[model samples]
Target: MTVTLAQAINRGIHDAMEADDRVLMFGEDVGKLGGVFRVTDTLQETFGTDRVYDTPLAESGIIGTAIGLAMYGFRPVAEMQFDGFAYPAFEQFTSHLAKMRNRSRGRVKLPVTVRIPFGGGIGAVEHHSESPETYWAHTAGLKVVSPGTVADGYAMTRAAIAADDPVIVLEPKRRYWMKDDLELPVTTEPLHKAVVRRPGTDVTVVAYGPMLKTAMEAADAAEEEGWSLEVVDLRSLSPIDTDTLVASLQRTGRMVVVHEAAQSLGPAAEIAARMQQEAFYHLEAPILRATGYDTPYPPAMLEEFWLPDVDRILDRVEEALDY
Candidate 1:
């Protein structure tokens, strides 16, 4: 069956709630309004107010409460309405949610999933379109992941909810409407692994979430220009599947990391550093990145120039090939 990425996520939440009595979701506008993106549409109605409901307009309060709920054996999914809005909850997440399991010496399990709709391309307001995955991914004890495809959106959400550790699921706001013909209960791909979406030998392009499709599109377009680009999706930001990435680099000998976030100090920087350390001998060219400008997410009118797009990715691919 064909389903949009948003629908796939909705299905994932439905399956999760049905599978576990302890699985519950809460966030701003998630109850009657069905989330700002409607990804939680009809879920509150199906699961009832007890299992799926709304919370006050407080990101820190929402996450702080989820941590307590997790301690009580409830697998809570807390949504941070927008990427920038999640900043207020950083203290609760890093201090408590990400530390409880270790603080208790493995006696406590934090089955909390913090779902964030992140990245830009929708030309929305500043705060509504920020890519902040690097913040959570860098935090210790937090397993950070972002889904690129419809299947991953379904499977990874379930995987995050089932795990005993805290998981941050960053959904690409721009790619939510992307549709694919994958059925529910999708492929059993591990949440922490990076997968090759397209194969080639000339160059490797690494991306995830909002930038995955753009990378793939650039790869396809590169073929007509007589270049072969392999696209790898880094599904898990933290604990990146470096083996998969290094293996691809071993074959291609060149790579370009792309993301919607700023290039400096973002996930791309960490991945590039890892490749330099792990696959330095095999690299034919220095790793390059095509990412958002180092400034604040630009206003909607100028976002096209700020966010990474097909041309930007292609330019990086061409540069990698030229080197």
Candidate 2:
């Protein structure tokens, strides 16, 4: 059955709650309000207020307490109302939840899933459009992932809940309304690997979150101009799907890394570095980057220039091919 990406998340969590009595969720207004974006609508009622409850607006406290609950054998799913609000919990996440099992020499485990609604496009005020994936990806012990499609939204949520380690799942806020008949087999692909959304031969465009949709659109725009673009949705960000990325670059000999993060030290930089190390000889040009400028995400009025649109991606593509 076809469903919007947002609905998939709603249904998927419902399934997870039914599948495991130990699963619980906590966040700001996740109870009666179902979250700031309504992703958790009705979750509290169905799961009972005890299983799905709201917590104080302190991110650190939410995560720190969730870690303890995890130690007690409860699967905790913590939600950050917005991407920018996750900073306060960073210390607790990296220091405790991420290191519990390793510190115990594998004696104990922390099973936690943190759902963050992120990325731009809805056009809101400050602190609403920040992309902080790099900060968490830089963390050592946490598994970071994002879902670009309804199918992935469901599968990744389920997989994260079952993992005995802490996982951060960033849901592209701009894509909640996007829907599709993602009836693909459940076992078709690994949640931690990259997925090829489009096949091509000219160049490889690596993107994640909402940028995945933009990359697909860019591929279509270039198709008429005789350029074939292989669009790869980097589903898993932390343990990057480097193997898939390297193989694709080896074949294309050109690459364009796109993301909504600032240019310096962004995911694009990491990808560019890897491609250079693994496929420098095979490259036809320098790895082109189409990224958010090295400035804070501006007001919605200026985001068109900040976020890489089709024009931006294709402009870089031209430079790469012309090189």
Candidate 3:
């Protein structure tokens, strides 16, 4: 029950593979290398090479093959080597996999999951730490989900594998090693529900994936400064859990959306618009967003200034409280 975020994800994938004979996993370095982070190690030995294997250095081929496999009644889980690498597969995803269900008039479904390691931290090189969840979420037929905790990572993988639609699982690469104390039997929730990570009446800090940890840290730091900050992990990014967030905003009267993606038309923009439409009268100040710079993720040295951290989140929280 007590596992690091990375182990939880690995265990989740193993569970899905064991439960379904039709489930297959393929990605660069996945079979022999066990993934660049060792998340898929030992899978090929356990599941057989046919079920777990590696692909060439082509993102489009990975996705295109996965789509074909899904059409043949297999649930394919394809991993994009890095956030930037997924760009080449966008056509296959948005044009083919994402539209299959709708294009088939709901007669056929593409039960495939695309796993992309995204977001910055750990002093990563360029493209390895890019946050590109917004791009996938923008696709209509794709269901986008990001895990903010070990339990979410485990449960959502199972849920996504079972769904009858294409799903994009965005793993926060930076939080892969962040250890935590998990409960036995696993604290589980719906795949589309937002989790109230920290409860307070003052203000709500909404984040998913990597930014949830920062928001929680900011909440802890804010407590020391006598500000009770509520942190909500927006688990489902595309079909966002607006009902849960609307309740939080009504109670807190202020909201801050935090993410590592650029500020424009990102998840924050969608959440802010939802909040403004649903809880306009309850808000004490305009919904705020604490996110990465509009520019690309900088080098290891400058990424510190670009990514949203505890200090930056707290600064925005204070500004919202003042307003």
Candidate 4:
């Protein structure tokens, strides 16, 4: 079926709810309004108010209550509306939802899925376009995963809901409208594994979510310059697919990490360090990063300069190739 990425997510939610009685969802405008992106469109109608519904305009309250529901043996999928809006629930998520299992010595489990629309290129106002996945990924005990394509968008959501622990789904808002003709009932793949988007040998580029398309585009452009760039999509940000990444780096001998988030301490830094540790002897050049500047996310007008594009990614690849 040909469907938009957001519609695939909606189907994922429907399948999850149908497959598990414990599965339920709540978030701002998710019910009657079908979410700000319409990703939850008609979900409440299909699942009913008890299973799929809306919550008050409180991020903290929504997450805090969802945590309680999870601890009580329910699988709750709580939407944060936007990446920037999710910060208000940080205390509830990190302090309790993320720590409850460890704190209880395995006596309690938090089977929760937090769906957050993240990243830029949507020309959205402030608070709607930040890539805050790093914060959640850095926090211990939470599984952070992002999907780069329509197939992944469907599979990862089911995987996230099935996880016994907390999982954060950082949906790329800009890619929501992208279309794909995927077979229905797509089998779920390992949520923590990375996949090669394009196979090459001259260099390896690692990216996920909003940046994966950019990385692939850069690889396409690099081919014309006689550089074969392999692209790895780091699907799981927390427990990164080091094995896949190392294998790719071993083949290419050079790596370039790309993301829309600021460069300092971002996922790119961690990926670079891991490649250094695992593929140190094979590295032909230092792992370079093409990322957003250290400053706050620029206004929509200047986002073109702020976010990484094919040219920026190619520049980093050139540096690595030259080395």
The RMSD (Cα, Å) of candidate 4 is 0.8
Candidate 4, residues 1-323, lDDT tens digits: the string is: 89988999998998999999999999999998999999999999988999888888999999999989987889999999999999899999899988989999999999999999999998888878898878998899899999999989999999999999899999999999999887877864599999998999999999999889889888889889999999999999988989999999999999999999999999999998888998899999999999999999989999999999999999999999888
Segments of candidate 2 deviating more than 4 angstroms: none
Instruction: Give lDDT tens digits, candidate 3, residues 1-323.
Output: 56888788778889899989999999999998899987787999999999999999999999999988999999998899789889999899889988988988998888999888888887987778888888888899999999999888778877888888899999988888878765644558888889898899899999999888889899999999999998999999878999999999999999999999999998999999999999999999999989998997899999888889998898889899999
RMSD of 3: 1.1
Clashing pairs in 2: none
Total colliding residue pairs, candidate 2 = 0
| Model 1: pairs clashing at backbone N, Cα or C within 3 Å | none
Per-residue lDDT of 132 in model 1: 88
- The residue ranges of model 4 lying beyond 4 angstroms of the native Cα positions read none
Q: By summed lDDT, which 10 consecutive residues of candidate 4 come out lowest?
A: 180-189
Task: Give the TM-score (vs. native) of candidate 3.
Answer: 0.98
lDDT of 1 at 239: 72
Give lDDT per model, in order: 0.92, 0.89, 0.89, 0.92
lDDT score for candidate 3 against the true structure? 0.89
